[model samples]
Target: MGSSARLRLYMNDNGPLILDGGLATELEAQGAKLQGDPLWSARLLHTNPQAIRDAHHRFLLSGADVITTATYQASITGFIDHLDVSCERARELLMSGVHLAKETAETFVCDARPAGQRCPLVAGSVGPYGAFLHNGSEYTGAYAQEMSIEEFKVWHRPQIDCLAAAGADLLAFETIPSIKEAEALIELLREFPNSQAWLSFSCKDGTCISDGSSFSEAVQMANRCTQLVAVGVNCCSPALVEPLLQSARSLLSPDMSWVVYPNSGEDWDSEQGWLTSEKTSASISELGHTWMKQGAALIGGCCRIGPAHIAELRRELKGSCTSPSSAV
Candidate 1:
């Protein structure tokens, strides 16, 4: 894996890319109560490391080509209030997530029951500042008076650098809601010489993110960075993602790749706070089929989409994409 050789694989790969989700809460379902941290994101890190492996393995079994590490909310800044986990310790947990995924994929390939099929790739997942800030607001002026981009660079450098060191095949900056924030990360990504990455936004009305930037604008900004392999929408309601995909296809270059992984639905209640309704998954899969026809390169489930939803997507994908020309 020399620099030039690795860079070539990142830039030239053509075909559908599969990304997996459901690590934090999914780990909870597997009997791990990650308590002790008020920061919701760090809890997953405190949980059994094996829980991280199992959730990713489920996605791999469901046919995902790329498995994302469970490090979305595993930030040192997010857990400073907690006395138990130090910044360094929290970061190691995040890096461990990446290591576990890559190691798991290697294990699967080596122990393949049917030897011929290949295993999935590992994708390092990065989340926002534990809040709902958009790209522009993420870093600009007085809001972060206590911290500068240099400080952020110091905090995130370890997490991102560790992922690079842990053998992540790609980096997935997901659920990004603003062009400003996306650009901030794009700038950091340029520092990584040969690593491939994807940027995904969470839209509101199909055209605008929660911060109010047009979806097309987000694509234009992301495209400015040459290292980006794909731009997409994730963590928004299923209804919003469809029109966003359609709008995105019209603006993006056909040679570029597209990915979509919408939430089950928008409604949330006490019992299932932020959970996607069961019916939404089936409908989202139906919409995913149409998106595949329009130019989406990859498809999968995000929040609330369990194995059953992935099963539906896989089944639909069988007939949804028939020719390479149809995939964008």
Candidate 2:
């Protein structure tokens, strides 16, 4: 098979669909300072569009087949948290992130493709609601009259609608900690025409989300999507997701793919109050290949892992695969 065959397999099958994660936040951490930006805390708005595009380009070079738009923090939850901005403006920024990714891929990847391909398809990333539950969980229950589900519908509908309209190849909902949030997201995605969506859980351990729903239950619910193309895990430590895959494999249909985009084992400290960083390219690559073996057909990086890690993943994958077309 040729390049087209491999690309087609990546596009259609339950094999590794490598994605690059954490551009805006990672970029800021890498010292791309954006002072005075009201959205500085939001990362997506604080980071320069070119910088975000450049990060996507870097990921592609590192062998990422898919590059997600830096739209996670562009949402209402993110914007309000970072800048105290209105929901509408935040939604606009979210849509803008999608558009920027589209534009960037067209400019950078189209010319870089082997021959006939125009651009790398962009995955639109939707993050969970920023507000943590009183119990330190993220999945909230029935909305209050002030911020009811009905209100969220009005706030989030625009972002979901715009991402669909922007021709995002897939909807990648990341780090969802609640069953209610996942169901709501699936409902929202159903309203978008021609968009394929995937739901990912944020598990601190391999078994359950932060809110205590078992990973098995989460996968069962996510499989309910009428337009779901695939589902898996992201944002938690890599060590935790391997066994989770084993438990879910029996439930997942062969045609429906599984993804694993883990963080660098880093977390926010409680008493010290700082980011704990423990990601490495070698570790990420090793774990990525391990994830692939453990039933993660789609492998990639998340928080604290960047293009370098993605590149290493591609290198390792090329070395392991039998496909000649996988050669960079």
Candidate 3:
């Protein structure tokens, strides 16, 4: 079956899908210094790809049904400007990010998972345009003012082409902060007619996407996009998810599923990393059940969230989340 068909089949048998937690958080735990690096996790795609694979493996063992690639901050222009590579070399780096994640997922299933169950899917991580700016513009979407939808599409196409050609099962247009960008993505998906994807916005609160557009309208727009398998929030405060879904509940098409992976309730700094003062407010183990009730079939964490948190989510929902003897 195709990946989308397999998605339906898996959900029918597996209840809800458990997505992996933050890549940068896991990378840092494994000794990556990412602060001030424009590439963030994508840097590891070129310098330490084994680390990216290791992080994905940990999430799979922790009960993730889907693991996204390390290309979240990757873009052709960003790679060229920061990595000092030609456009062709930039494409190779983006492709490597997907290969690493795909390799990890395939190896994990072949070696450790059971024979009859569905193996985890690898999602190509496509962050918003602002992420390439290396600022907090991803949260505010202030950059949208500088680019038209056509321009936005132009900026994003190269990365999408590279990722889709690299063999990811799906694309994650994640942490988007504006409805304009989301609409641009909706149009862009039509160009890649056979690809499957999910669009997730970064919210300022429960009711509005970061650009202050009506999220209800965003959801309604996403409802019309056939290429999208899911739509919801990501990298926002966990407290905001309940109301965000609640607001969109009445309008959502039954065909469109929800996919959410909020942050660990920690604040961010463009100059510094996640602040140290925030207490552990993830409570993903407890809140994940609530989100599932809100139609979030795919759930996980973002910044400051790690493998242990994901394991707790699994143990809470699945009874046993990993193979005791499995090594990754």
- Write the residue-wise lDDT of candidate 1 on 1-328 in tens digits: 6533553464354434545655655665666664333444345555566767777767666556667887766555554445367877766766787888888777765654322234566778887553323223321222344545555455556667777777687788887755556677787887886777788886767688756778888888777777777888887677776788777676786546777887667454534456445665446667876777767777776766765566556556642221122211
Whichever of 1 and 2 has more TM-score, that candidate is 1
Top-TM-score candidate index: 3
Name the TM-score of candidate 3: 0.95
Lowest lDDT sum, 10 consecutive residues, model 2, at: 319-328
Top-down TM-score ranking: 3, 1, 2
Candidate 1's TM-score: 0.81
Candidate 3, clashing residue pairs? none
Stretches of model 3 off by over 4 angstroms after superposition: 115-117, 276-282, 323-328
Q: lDDT (0-100) at residue 143 of candidate 1?
A: 35
Q: Clashes in model 2: which pairs?
A: none
- Predictions in order: lDDT: 0.64, 0.65, 0.87
**71-188 in candidate 3: lDDT tens per residue?**
9999998889998999999999999988988888889878886434468988899999989988889999998988899998998999999999998888999999988888898899
